[model samples]
Structures are given as structure tokens and as C-alpha cells.
Target chain A: MWKWLHPYAKGEATYRLLGAWLPWLAGSALVTLTVGLVWGMLFAPSDYQQGDSYRIIFIHVPSAMFSMGAYTAMAITALIALVWQIRTAEWAIAAIAPVGAVLTFIALFTGAVWGKPMWGTWWEWDARLTSQLILLFLYIGVLALYYAFTDARTGAKAASVLALVGVVNVPIIHFSVYWWNSLHQGATITKFEKPSMAPEMLIPLLISILGFALLTGALVCQRLRNEILKQEIHRPWVHAQLGVAEQER
Target chain B: MAFDSWYDFIDMGGYGFYVWLAYGVTLLALTILVMHGLRTRKQLQQQAVQQQQRQQRLARRKQQERGTA
Candidate 1:
């Protein structure tokens, strides 16, 4: 089972894999985001109550969703690094943390912007919002820990532990609204039953979510390739790769 | 089709400021992230290229010294 993944455990192989996928990830992200944004902003019907302010949901929900998604991915990568002692997986954690942090910030900022119109406040210490804030801090913490040590391996181990511990917050962030009295609304797409949103609105929201996910993948690949280069700069492979790039240029 | 005109769409039914602000900020953040990733990759690639050049120069100097010896 895991044997098939053995080849990719090598840094060069993993780097090549990511390079192969980056174009597809970026291309699809662009296509889906354009379709979703244009449709959601220009064609999706207004909410009966919130009017067009509800349109902010197009970005807010997706960013909020993917922020958690990125953290979960980081935590899993951390697990692989710590348990299997995989260098590639360790590098993956560093690649993921910044993107997760940025997405978390986007989610919080969009939520605050949307909150002003719906909840009549820029922010609140509600369960959902607070947990999400904590998630952002957790990402920053992981990043800070990863760089705090001069020994890269020691730093990676510390960051991996932090990432694992912080993952409990992901579920808490997702379920906070239902678990506590909160100004934030409950689930839309993740519900057990059909999503509450109309098909017209829900369709675009789903597309936007995919677009964000693809963008995250592309960004992570970009960072991971950089990490590999930084780690392998002295290797003959790195020299050869750079030589090829130079010749092309 | 939700809005009848360009102004109506931009206005976003009187909630234009909030909607546009949210979109604008999200775009800005993502753009920053993408730009930063691109810049970092380029810098690292440059560093690798420079290291390669230095190694080649060292090899060339060693060859010349060996020939003279």
C-alpha cells in the first residue's frame, strides 16, 4: 500500500511531482475562480433579507473552509514527517503554514467585513469567530516554531509537534457555532441534509470553493519546490537542475 | 442578470461598500501571497544559479593550476 508512495519520498522525485502538477493546479484555479466570481457577483440572486451583502458569502465561506483545510493538511504532513522521518514531508509543513495563515487571515477579514452588515458589528468574541482566530494563531505559531531553531531538523520536529497539537482546533472551529451561542451562522454546504442555499447560489459557491482549493495546492507546490531547493542546494541534482534552467534562459 | 445595469451591479443593492471591500481585501491578500511565493522561488533559483557558477569557476581555476604544476 504505502510502498507505491516510496519513490516520492525522495526530495527530487517529490519536487518533480509538484512541478508537474503546478500548471494544472494554477490553470484550473484560474478557470474556476473566474467562472465562480463572475457568476456569483453578477448573476446570483440577491438574498431576500440581506440583499446583495450576502454576496460576500461567495468568498467568505470558501476562504474560511480552505483555511481549516490547509491546517489539516499541514498537520497530516507533520505526522508523516515525525513518524516516518520523511524530509520531504517536513518541508511540506513549512510550505503549507504560510498559505494556511494567509487563508485564515482572509477568512477572518472577510467575516468581519460581512459581520458589519449582518450582525451590526465588525467582530465579536463568539465561539466560531474566536476559534477561527485561534486557528490563525496556531498557524503563526507553527511557522514561528519552525524557524526558531538554528538546526533545521530540530526546528522541524518542534513545528511538527505544534502542528499536531493545534489540529484539535480545526474541528472546534468548524462546530463552534452549533456548540455555542454565536452570531455566526451554522453550516451551509457541510450539513447532513441538502445545503440550505438555493442551487443557483450554491453552485457558484461550490465552484469558488474548488477554485480556492486549487489555488492553495498551487501555492503549496510553489513553496515546497523552493524548500526543496533550499535544502538541496549543495546536491549535484540541484546544480544540474539550475544548469538546465540557465541554459534554457 | 441579478442587476439590470453596470451601476446597479457595482452598487450591489446599496451594500456595495461592504461587498466590494470584502472582495477587494480578499483579492489583495491572495495576490500578495502569490506574488510572495513567486519572488521567493525566483530568489532561491538565483541563489542556486550563483552557487553553480561559483563551483564552475573554482573547477576551472583548479584545472589551470594543475596544468601549470
Candidate 2:
């Protein structure tokens, strides 16, 4: 039943798989982001009321979406490491933390920037914003725990525990706007009602989201590959693989 | 060509700052991330090579000691 999973549980196999994925992910990210940015920034029509201010949504929305997604991914990896005691899973959890942290920062920063003009203040202790602030702290906590210990394995375990615990807050962050009538508007993209956006605006926004997702995937794969190589340096398979590349060096 | 002039593009109907700032920051962050990943991979590869060399040296020394004994 778990036969397919067994092969990839090993660091070497995981490293190779991620290696193959990195170029594809990176290439797709480059192309999509180029198209999305150009289309959204220039081609898309200005908003009716907010005019160009609403254009910020292309970046703000996607970063905010991925910030939550990356954390959820980290938590799942943490759970896998804990339950299955897979070293590769532990590495994955650690590899994702910094990337997730940066994405969360981007979300919060862009959110604040967008808020200034819309809300007439740089920031407010609104439910949605506050919950996102907590999310940033959670990302920091995981990274801090990772570096707190001397033993790599012990640090990974500790960080995984923190990541799993931090994941409990994700839902709270996501629902804060819905749970309360906060200043922050309810989700535009996810609402079941017909989208308020015109087709021109909607198309570019969707493209931006897809582009950001691809970039995130590429970054994660590359980082995970690095983590695997670092952790498995002492293993025979790693040395054998390096031997094959010795000529290139 | 999208707008009549630089000023018109910059005005963006008065939403220019918000729109451009968001896109600018997004581009900067993603570029930094990609560069960091590539740099980290190179550093890790270097460290792996060093570790392999150290292991090989230790193994050779042990073999020499055994031969002498």
C-alpha cells in the first residue's frame, strides 16, 4: 500500500525528485510571472472607484493566499515527520520555514501598504490584520526553534513541534474577517456569489495568483533539495552521487 | 503606448503608488528568494565535497596504520 511512499522516504530519492522538479517549476514561474505582471499592471482596466489602487490586489491577494498555504504545508510536513519518523520530512519542514516566513512578511507588508490609502491609516488592530500578525510571529517561532539547538536532528524535531502547534492558528486567521465584521473586506476570490470583478481584472488577478504559486513551488523544491543534501552528506549514497559529479567540480 | 505619457502612466487614475508599490515589492522579494536558493545550494554542495574529502582522508590514514601494524 505504501510501496510508492517507501522509495521517496529516503533522502537520496527525494533529492533526485526535487532536482528534476526545480527547473520546471522555476521556468514556469518566470514565464507566468512575466505575463501576469505585464497584463495586470498595464493591460487591465483601472478600477471604477479606487482606480489603480485596486491593482495592488494582484500582489496582495496572491501573497496573502500563499502565506497561509505555505504554513499549512509546513504543518503537514511536520506531522509526517512526527508520525512516520521520516528524516526527509523533518528536513522538508525546516526548509519551508524561512520561505514561509518571507512570504508572510510580504503579505503583511503589502496588506499594510494597501490599507494606508483605503483605510486612511497605515495599520489598524482589525481582526484580520491582527490574526495575520500572529501568523508572522508563528513563522518566526519556527525559525527560532530550528536554530536554538546545536544538534540538527533535535532542532528539526523541536521546530516541527512548534510548526504543528502554530498551524492551529491558520483557521483563526482565515476566518477572522468572516467571523467579525472587520474593516478588512471579506474574500473576493473565494465567495460563492458571482465575482464582483470584471472579466478583464479577474483574468490578470488569476494569472498573478498562478504565477506566485509556481514561484513558491520552485523555491520550496530548491530549498528542500539543499536541505536533503546537507543532512545526508555523511551517507554513502550521497558520497556516491557526488563522485559522479566530481569531474564537473 | 498604453498611456499617452509617463505622467499618465504614473497617475494611473490616482492609484499609481499603491499599484506600482505592490508589484515592485513582489518582484524584489521573489528575485531575492530565487538568488538565495541558488546560493544556498552551491554552499551545500561545497560542504558536501569537503565532508567527502575528510572522510576519504580518515579512511586512508586508518588503512595505512593497519598495514604498518
Candidate 3:
């Protein structure tokens, strides 16, 4: 496994790996998001309680879901970089942070939009809402810290430690509704039990979730590939492939 | 299917503001992420190519100078 993983840990190999997977991720994301969101808003039956407003669930839930997911992913990458001492992993931390920050922003934006009618307010200080807001700050902090230092290595080290520490908030965000009597609703789909929603409503949401996941994968892969190119531009392999640097003399 | 007509669909059963707002914000954010990533990647790729060219130019200059010497 070490031998298998070591090669891919190199910038070029990882770039190729990401390139190979990019198409599948993009294709699946395109198909799923189109089908899921369209059908969700148009064809899926309206909810008994929230009516058409509940259709927002298609975006809100998925964005919120991925916000936490991206954080966890970043934390894992930080762990990999720290433990394995991999430059690619550190680059991945930089690549992942921006996307994660954007996803967190999406989650917060959609959540606020969803809240206005349901909770009768655009903003709330409830546990679930508050913790999720904090998650956004943590993401911003990661990005900010990443660019704070003159040396990227130093910046990444600081960001990695922050990401590792911020992971504790992920669970708090997840279980906050359960932990407190919050205005936000409790979990719709938990692992241990059946989903609370009907098939028509649940199916579209599940599809949207998959779509969002695929989109995230595609974006991350593309970002990683770009980071590899930028970081490894001076490497012999990169120069050899370009064939422009060595010939210009 | 959920609405009686196009207007009703747009109205989103009177929650149009909230529903559309949520979807709109989500889509806008997605678009921003995509555009930003693409633009940054392109710029980085361009920078990489330019740097490579500069390196090659310097290398050739040195080799030519050495050959002449």
C-alpha cells in the first residue's frame, strides 16, 4: 500500500490521477444536478406542511451536508500532511480550503433563506444555526491563515493545525438540533433509522445530495490538479513535459 | 404538477421569495466557485508556462556564452 500510495503522493502522479477522474466527476455532477434539482423543484410532490417552500430543501440540505463534509475532508488532508509529510497533501489543504469556504457560505446563505418562512426569521441564534455559522468562520480562518505567512509551508502548518482543531465543531453542527431545542428541525435522514420523508420528496433530495457530492469531488480534483501544476512547475518532470524551458536557450 | 399554472409555479405556493431565494443563492454560490476555480487555474497554468519559458531562455543564454568562451 505504501509503494502504491507513494507514487501518487508525488505532485505529477497525483495530478494525473486527478485528471483521469475529473471527467467522470464532471459528467456525473452535470447529469445528477440537472435531473435532481429540476425534478425536485418541478416534478416532486409538494410537502403538506411547507408547500413549495420545502422545495428549498433540495439545495439547503445538500449544501449544509457538504459544508460539514468538506470540513471533515480538509481535516483528513491536514492529518495526512502532518503525519505523512506529503507536499501533495499540503497542497490539497490549500486547494480544499477555498471550496470548503464557499460551500460553507452556500450552506449559510441557503439556510438563512430557508429560515425566513419556516422559522419566521432570517437569522437565529439557536445551537444548530450558531454552530454552523462557526463552521463558516473556521473555514474562513483556514484560508486566512493559509495566506498569512510569507512562507507557504509555515502558513499551511498553521492552517493544518487549525483544521484539525476545528473538526470538533463538525459534530457539534451535526447534532446541535438534537442537543438543543433549536428552531431548526432535527435530522431528516440518520444512519440508524429510516428516513422521515416520503419517497417522492426523499428521492429528489437524495439525488441532489449525490449531485452536490459529485460536484464537490469534481471541483476538488480540478483544484488539486491546478495546485500540482503551480507547485511543481520548477520540477524536472514538469520542465521536461513542457519542453519549452530547456529549448529556449 | 404541484401548481395550477405557470404563475402558480413561479409563486411557489406563496413562498416564492424564500424558495427562490434559497435556490438562487445556492446557484449563485456554485457559479462563483466554478468561475473562480477556472480563472485561477488558467492564470496559474499561464504563469507556469511563462516561468518555464523564462527558465529555458536563461539556460540557452548560459550555454551559448559557455560555448563561445
Candidate 4:
């Protein structure tokens, strides 16, 4: 139950846990991404309509999905921090912000590149596009707010509040295409029924999605460890770890 | 494979520019983020080591002052 999570609430325990998970996350991410990208880019048949341009979906859909996923993770961590007063949860918010921001940027960029050939324009003010853009701003806002204050506690508190407020945007981004007549297409993988895509295309897309998720996991672990080090700099455990790290060097 | 030759693959059925650009940009951004994370972690550990050393020096000086006084 919740009891198992109790150990990870401690900074040192969480740090070790992330350390244990990093190699596995990184290795799987590498394997899946390579296989997925190669299969999607080369072997997958061209779309009957869009032809080879559809290959962008391999990266675009995964990045777009994980962008929202990262924000949702941040909101959960923020809730944990506020509700339980967990310092490690607070550090997780900082760990996730920039990665989510980058994912959002990738989504926007890839969507634009995909749009140019399909929609005849680089951008549109459609619901889906604009909502995702706002998501990018929200991530930046959380990051900016986290560092704006001189006091770390006050900064984390303010940033956690902002993250909680920003949770509202995740749903908006997901539903924007449906809520308004938009240029952006509806779901390909997340449809209520089976995916609209064929298995040839869909399989690699799913693999790429797994790759993106795992890569994000590895990146977050690295960032969380860094956050722990930064916050626990004056603690003896941090000093001992650093000394050991030096000896290993 | 979808393409018959190197040229055909590179062309990507005339959508090559868009496809490659998207992939290239995504790879570049992710690489930068990963590299930055690794570099920052090393720097922070170094900074922590320095801070620890400084604290040790300060403590030794305080102990010496108490002994002489």
C-alpha cells in the first residue's frame, strides 16, 4: 500500500532508488528508440494519402503525448508536496519542469513541420495548437517562478501552487481539437477503439512512445539526483557521496 | 524497405525535407538536454566537494583558536 512509498519520501532513499533505475531506463530507451525510429522511418509503408511525410508521426505523436504526461506528473508531485510537505516531491517538480518544457517545444516544432505539407501553413491559431502553446508557457512559468525567490522554501511553495493551477491546462490541451473546429487531427493511438492506424504503422509508433517515455524517465532520474545534491549540499551524506565519487574517478 | 535505393530513401518521396528536419531538430534538442543534465550534475558534485572542504577548514581553524585561547 502507501507504506512502501514511505521510504522513497526520504531524500537519500529516493536518490538511491533513482540511481538503481537509471541504467535500466537509459538502456531500454536507447534500444527502443533506435528500433522504433529505424522501423518507422524505413520499413513502414508510406501513407496512401500523405506518403512519406507521415513518418514524422513516429516522433511527433510520442513527443506530444509525453509533453502532457510530464505536466501531469508535475501536478501530482506538486500535490504531494503541498499535501504531505515532502521535500523530495518538491525537488521532483523542479526536475520535471525543463524536460516538460522541451517536450512541449518538440511537439510544437514537429507539429509545425508536419503541418506545412499537410495544411499548407507552418502554423494556425486552432484550438489544439494554441492550447499546446499555452502549455509551453506554463512550463516556463513554473520554472521561472521556482527560481525567482531568494528563499528556496518560498520559491518551491510558489512554484507548486503554479503547477497545481496549471493542471487545468492539460485537459484543455487534450480536448482542444475536439472542442473547436481545428486543423489538428484527432487521436491516432489514444482513440477509444483500436487505433486508426494499421498495425505496421501502429506497432512502431507504440514502440517510439515507449522509447520517449523511458527516455523521459531516465532524464528525470538524472535531474532528480542533481536536485537532491543541490538541496542536500551541506549534509554529511552528500559530502560522503561526493568523496566516494571522487575516489571512483 | 519503402525505398529502392539510397537516393529514394533520402528523397522520402519528396517529403524528405520536412521529415528529416523534424527528426533532426528533435534529436538536437534532446541531445542538448541530456548533455546539459550530465554536465550540470558533475559541476554540482564538484561544488559540493569544495563547499565541504571549506567547511572542514573553518572547523579546524575554530578548534585551533579555542585550543590557543
State which candidate has the highest lDDT.
Answer: 4
The CA lDDT of each predicted structure is 0.91, 0.83, 0.86, 0.92
CAPRI-style docking class of model 2 based on DockQ: medium
RMSD of 1: 1.9
Query: lDDT tens string, model 1, B16-68?
Result: 99999999999999899889988987887788888877777788889889999
Worst 10 residues of 2 chain A by lDDT: A240-249
**Could you give candidate 4's per-residue lDDT for residues A165-230 as a string of tens digits?**
999999998888788899888898664687889999999999999999999999999999999988
Docking class of 3: medium
Best by TM-score: 1
Q: Which scores higher on TM-score, 2 or 4?
A: 4
- What clash count does candidate 3 reach? 2
Misplaced by over 4 Å in model 2 are A240-249, B66-69
Candidate 3: stretches off by over 4 Å? A239-249
Ranking by DockQ: 1, 4, 3, 2
| Model 1 lDDT tens row, A119-191 | 9999999899999999999999999999999999999999999999999999999889889999988899864
| lDDT score, candidate 4, position A217 | 97
Candidates 2 and 3 compared by lDDT, better number = 3
Clash list (residue pairs), candidate 2 = none
Preferred candidate (DockQ higher): 1 or 3: 1
lDDT of 3 by residue, A180-217 (tens): 89998888998999999999889889999999999999
